[model samples]
Target: MATKTPKNPQKKHDGRRKNLIDNKNLKSPRTGIRKWVYRFFVAIIWFLILLVPVTIYYAHDLPDISEITQPKGGSTVMVMDRSGGLLASYGDVYGDWLEFDDIPAVLVQAVIATEDRRFFDHGGFDIRGFMRAMIKNITTGRMVEGGSTISQQLAKNLFLSADKTLKRKIQELLFSAWLEMNFSKEEILTYYFNRVYFGSGAYGIDAAARIFFGHNARELSLIEAAMLAGVLKGPALYSPLRDLERSYRRMGDVLDNMVEAGFIQKSVAEKTKAENVQIVDKQTGGDERYFSDWIVERAASLIGRVNEPVIIYTTLMPDIQDKANKALQRIMDQEALTHKASQAALVSLDMDGGVRAMVGGTDYTVSQYNRAAQAQRQPGSAFKLFIYLAAFERGLSPDDVMRDSPVILKGWQPKNYSGEYLGQVTLREAFVRSLNTVAVKLAERINRKNVIEMARRLGLTTPIVAE
Candidate 1:
């Protein structure tokens, strides 16, 4: 009471002014929260405004969804022998179309586990996986992980080129969203199994199963399924045919992933990993690969661009082909080093001009040059047959005496292979001995043009210089 009595008017006014200033500066928590909420909405509005134009720009050239039902790229070319046994396949090999139910559950589980663990939970794009991949890439300072989902990969493979452009990425997102909206999860997986590329030119799960396991998709075991699923990362690089060790290691990773995803027990995964996976021997017709390659080229020439799957039944006899391969290999193994011969080719044609067996080289894996078809080698002693036939047609008897000594024609001397010449020999003796000089003399006597004409008539399409 005493202090109030002594209080000055100026002090009272100062206190009131201070209270008003404090009240003016005060703010409610709800007001601050409302302000932040307003800003968030404005930012979202701007983002949508920008995204609309960008989406439109990338969407203009989007592929038609109707085309998804049809197959794309180089069509499969299946080459079969005379007895309908598959020799080889070129281009994209697609198996029979499969529905969702037709695909093995183990295979489906393996793919889901390895490719996208959250595939079932996410709607087209996986935010959690994308974020994780982004964070991992950022931490590693490199693109060690990809943010693409199965849906996005399928969309890109089905409709777009693998261009890592911003436009392509946007298109992929849009297409994936569209796919999610239009197709069910089961349908999406069905399309994936039917269209995705597995190594070795396989375009579908069924084809991969048949190619790698020699069976249908329904027959894929846990180990086989894991191996096939692992090939999805890098088809050519991880293909068993390309690298068995790498493929096996990748299969172990896929099995581990399956265990992590709770699709299979860890013990089961371990057992499956330890089990021996029998891969179908793609080298069954390894030597015939050269023949298959030739057949494909000839087929392409006969039929323009290959736009659809085709079956080519050729005159190749598998038994004869095996024999030819063995014969060339045996010769190369036994005498190749001594003669310094690195390559050899053999071609057997039937009387009807059908190629029964063709071995392009000693080892097709090492060299694919078709010496049987592509080489332009000198006929050497082989040409003597044409000369002898021409002489026979010119009314020369086999018993007629002919000089086997060196003969000079146009300053070119022809000598026998043995380098030792018999002065005079019967035509039959010269023919049997493959005497080059005698054959040349006979050709000169009968006119060289007749020999060339005979060669042409005998199905020799190669150009021959008459000298």
Candidate 2:
């Protein structure tokens, strides 16, 4: 201190920081980037945590994994005769169930190729496949393909309804994931093959094989498998039974898919395409389906919801059904041009109310209305039977004479079908010749309520006007 420490003239190291003040005042671009990156990771973690609770809630409603072996029941209603002869079958027409190992390898390949090419590689959802499907559908302006995996389809068919909703889709995804975690690929595919619906009321692969090929699922040929797989796109649209041309085209598409997926070689696919499949013309063609349908609607109240196999004994006779179909066809072909009749129906019922033969319409595939039971055409002369019977019950005999002249009631004039009036006619003659004026006069005399009650007693269910 006395020498003033010979104070060496020197600058402090801390004062060098002042040289970098301008650089410190400027902000680096990476600071904001780092903050956002941290937030993004945190958001992802929160999303995963939230999904845990939602997944648990949905998992509780899912069927037990052990219950998967027993497929959800399907409706099956079998209508037969009193003699044990099968008349028709309604509801889910299923066949024998088959195990994974029992299913043919070619069929599995066909389904996987056509339905999901990345079936084995995905967990439950196929993002790449979904994206591709979206692009395709957007470009095509329609839903040309559904990117649902086999597991998802099985989940929907076994446990869910056909409602197209986001909640349902989420449930489907959850179930699909559960299926993937619990079951092997083969097991899931086996369940799918056993539960899917084919066209023509066929459910399951075995049923489809028997229904379309007249053979077991194990005996389905390669082309046949392709055709069956093709039908899965739109059961009714690509049904081989309804439209073979469309079915063939769809089969070719499936074959092409198989080739692309390496399930089959291109040459093999081409060869199979050249040799088309042969379908079995089952006896349940177009004609008997009408009877089957009519019997089903009538038996619905008696059977209720068909959950299991039910054998309903009906009074249908195949020979009679064939004869009736032929007779109706003959009549339509020969007399339609002459009588201006485009459609006709005939029902043969016994005294006990058992239907033996029924022809609903000219074609079942084209139109399903049962003319014999559904149509409400006015009975031109048939109503006269009830009117005359009602008059006879009121003490009028067939030999009684009546005026067949013009009659007007409430501004409604009833006349003969031939548009000509007879001056007088006996009740018997009026009955035989279907004289409209005489029948109206008798209805008036016997009181219209009596005629209405008589018609109601005769099983007329449609509406009747008094005027």
Q: Pick the candidate with the highest TM-score.
A: 2
Tens-place lDDT per residue, model 1, 370-445, is: 6788777987787888888888998999999988886787788877888999988999999899988888788889
Residues 1-467, model 2: lDDT tens digits: 36654343445444555455447776545567798998899999999999999878766776555667765567777777656777666667688888999888888999989888899999988998889999999999778889898899888867776667776788899889989998899889888998888856677899999887888998888999999999998775677875677789999999999999888899999999999677776555467777776676556435444466777677888788889999999999999999998789999888798888889888866554567776668888878889999998989899999988998888989878899877778999989989988888898899898999999998987767786
CA lDDT, every prediction?
A: 0.85, 0.82
lDDT for position 352 in model 2: 90
- Deviation from native of the Cα of residue 330 in model 1, angstroms: 17
Alpha-carbon TM-score of each model against the true structure: 0.55, 0.57
| CA error at residue 45 for candidate 1, angstroms | 1.1
Q: Best candidate, lDDT-wise? A: 1
Per-candidate clashes, comma-separated? 0, 3
**Position 265, candidate 2: lDDT:** 92
